[model samples]
Target: MSNSKGRHRKEYHEPKISEIEKLVSSFRSAHGHDKLMDSLRSILGEKPKTLHKAKKEDTKGSAEPKISELEKIFQHFKEIHGEEKLKQSLNEATGRDNQKPHKKDKTKEHNIYVDREIKFKKVKSKDVAKDIINTAKSFYGFVREKLKYKKYRYPAIAISILMGIYLLFNLPLLYMRMNWEKPADTQKLIVKTQETVQKKMADSATLAPGEVVPAESRLIIPKINVNTPIVYANTKDEKVVQDLLHNGVVHYQDTAKPGEVGNSFITGHSSNYWWDTGKYNYVFTLLDKLERGDQAVVYYNNKKFVYTVRDKLVVEGSDMSVLAPTDTPVLSLMTCTPPGTSWKRLVVRFDITDPVFHKPETVTKENVVEVPKEKEKKPGLISRFFSFFMPN
Candidate 1:
């Protein structure tokens, strides 16, 4: 017991690499390698391991790296017998029992995520292509159905017809409203005339050339019964011209004024859309009806100047020859030709035949007392566009 206590225990013994190499060399040099393998087993104290089937570890799986069939079998038997026994078996199979262990490289392991990602992209692309193809097929089928089937067609046709009727019923009334003319306020004209006549009776005098009096600024054309205000604006704009004409005759702003030396130009619509606004728009329509002896009287400064029609001419719309300055005092009454078209211009030339101050008594008393006999409902052009929406 004392010797046993003083003695040391034998440490663990492993087969040396050099000894294994020498064994493998001797096994190779032996005449009969099978007999040598048997000898090695007896000397090494174990039977040679053989692979009859797959090892348990291969079937069981591992937490570490995925191993091959050979490695799994080697590991299972290594736990059972010994490392040397497995090496001998490996040598018998591969003839390299003394070979060095191969180092494992980190890059050799396959990435499952990378493989899945590639597969996912391929599947996603295929799905997108299928969706596109399906959408096109559905659209084509819908168009074909619409063309071949007549189930929804009659309702569509009915809707279109109803819309057409609605537009037709409202459009003409709309056109009439947009283009209706404003009738003159005969009551206001009568009142103004009465006041003017009263003022004129107080200070009637023969007007000198270029002399404009405050009391007299009336333009009377007895032929057409045109008696309205003369609108003068400093602009030659067409819109201004139209606006002025919409109120009354436009005295061309660039031309000579009344009782002046150059031609005093006066223009009014000969004819317009019967619905267009303005009372005196057709004032000049009857202008051409007047004969050479018919008179146009201008009252200025309580003084009167009478002009006699001399000649009338039809000229192209582009003609500015009639607008030239004349040596004599003249009144050029112009209007659009053929009553409605602006293709040509009609000018009725007038000479200041008899310049005279009218006696106050001769001025018509009936005109001042006159009111329009007919009651006209005149909703102006702009008002008509929105008046339907409002309560009357």
Candidate 2:
């Protein structure tokens, strides 16, 4: 057993010098074959032999130096990673801080509205007192100005009072003038004049056929609702005759006498006065609507002459030929055309039918009979005089 043990120990013993040299040669062949010495010289800044001596001196110290170098390497790795992560974390933190200040400023601005309401309440008492004093001062100044102008105010009041009184007195007259009165007195005068003229006409010894007496007459047209008194034809007279025949009176120079043949014409003022209420605004409005068979009656010398409407025509006023006498025994009523404008004239023509004379003795037909001499003149001068005041 001892001999076997001795052989085993020899096999596991440390290598000899020659064996170590062989092992080193093998290592150089495998790992340090290409520029191994030059690589070592560059890292150490010396030949491999010099580096070995320096390594031997460094090994003479305790293991603590080697351990500290190892610790330093590990610390360097930790510092590098820590610095990178810290820098990234610091950048994120800075971004959050900047956002926090912006949010704080917004909150401050929103709260200012509440501050303003509180400030306004503090100012209200002083402002109200100042405004009240300013208003009182303005009103006082206005009252003083009114007192200074009192002299002018009195005259204005007096003038207004006088105007009111004048208007009150004139109001009734204005109303009466505007309305149409029946003129019964004027009708009576017209009837009396007509009786006298007929009596004279019948007594051939006293009057000729063409001779015309200066007597007033009246005309009535029931269809047109006209019952106006006729006045003597005088261009100088400025009265409005009620009926169409009175209108004929104005053109007496160009028209036949009330008893004669040929066209008898008349003219009158239609409107345009304070008294005008448009009542006579269209006196001929109904006249223009008259048909062929309509009757137009004329009263003169207490007699009635009935005529039938024949034709109607509107012509420019410049064309006066329509007013000229026609051969037919016709009565023509002429008025300004267009009612309001005198630019034209309307002429209505009528054919007379039966001509009758009414006297105190009898209502006779066209033929006049001779009466005995004992009868006083039927229409005396008194009747004629009273007729002058008639409304026509």
Candidate 3:
């Protein structure tokens, strides 16, 4: 017990001679050396030098020695006059009436608090990658330890791994949907449409007047950032329409093409298989973000038609009435409901507000339709294999 107490207790010692010299120098610097010398002489029973006499001596180039040399003189006097007397004289000269407070007493009298701030540590990319790998390993180890004695441990781990792989492939879709928004510059789409029209006009000489050029048709929805070509499939055949969707949004056959007195049925994929080779696999993934009063533009032939979204509805996948003709020109955008799933059809309807539709007879020469020549191209083995799976 005594050894433990001795080990725990902190021992204290008086200041050494060198430390006292440093303190004396600091005192002399604070209260001029003349005042320090006068105080020391008064304590030592010697005549103190007058300030006027000291100043006169300094003028004559006979200045006092520095603190270092004065300390040596003090040490010589301490040996002759006695150590305790010199210490008392030094304390009186320095104006220190008592010893320093104990460490415990100082701590109790003054409470010191250090504020530790937490900052976000920026690390190198390689270090960040190493941390991620370490975290993954730790998680794997924890899971393995918890499932070690279970009868269904292997099956549980297999399911967990499969789920992880599925999320790895599908998590991007969730992030894309959450952050989707209309581009700030909506006029750029119109500018792009004008450029496409001007370029197509240059190639119009090859086609007859009033005959539609399918390549010139484009659909621009500012809300969803869609500026894709419109593929006019002149048939209701599901297989033919599905194939055309791979190229762009397919415009249903026998329907009013943009600026006509009927609903222009257009369909696109909300989401497609991850391994699908088509560039438009996720073109309409954010189609459900559109609200009423939004705009959809269609560049048909050389004319531009603008429509306002009036309403939206989800119908059964087998619903055919949405394709029915209307007295006023309307544009219907169809995509699979809930994205990635084909349980229902999300149909967004827009009424033509531009050109001020008067009647069916108002259709100009540009509204004349023509069947587009099907350009045959060979598909790869992967594309052909996936094409037989669904109608998307």
Q: Which stretches of candidate 2 lie over 4 Å from their true place?
A: 1-216, 235-251, 273-282, 356-392
Better of 1 and 2 by TM-score: 1
Winning model by TM-score: 3
**What's the lDDT for residue 242 in model 2?**
40
Backbone clashes (count) for model 3: 0
For model 1, residues 77-141, the per-residue Cα lDDT tens digits are 55556877766654654366435788854343233334544554455555766765655665555
Candidate 3 residue 113 Cα shift, in angstroms, is 99
| By lDDT: ranked, best first | 3, 1, 2
Best by lDDT: 3
- Judge candidate 2 against the unseen true structure and give its global Cα lDDT, from 0 to 1: 0.52
The model with the greater lDDT, 1 or 3, is 3
lDDT per residue for candidate 3 within 115-226, as digits (tens), equals 1111113332567667666556655655665577576597897898997887678676644544443333222111111111111112122333675544488888888899
- lDDT of each prediction vs. the true structure? 0.64, 0.52, 0.69
Q: Which stretches of candidate 1 lie above 4 Å from their native place?
A: 1-216, 356-392
Among all windows of 10 consecutive residues in model 1, the one with the lowest summed lDDT is 194-203
**Clashing residue pair totals per candidate (backbone < 3 A):** 6, 8, 0
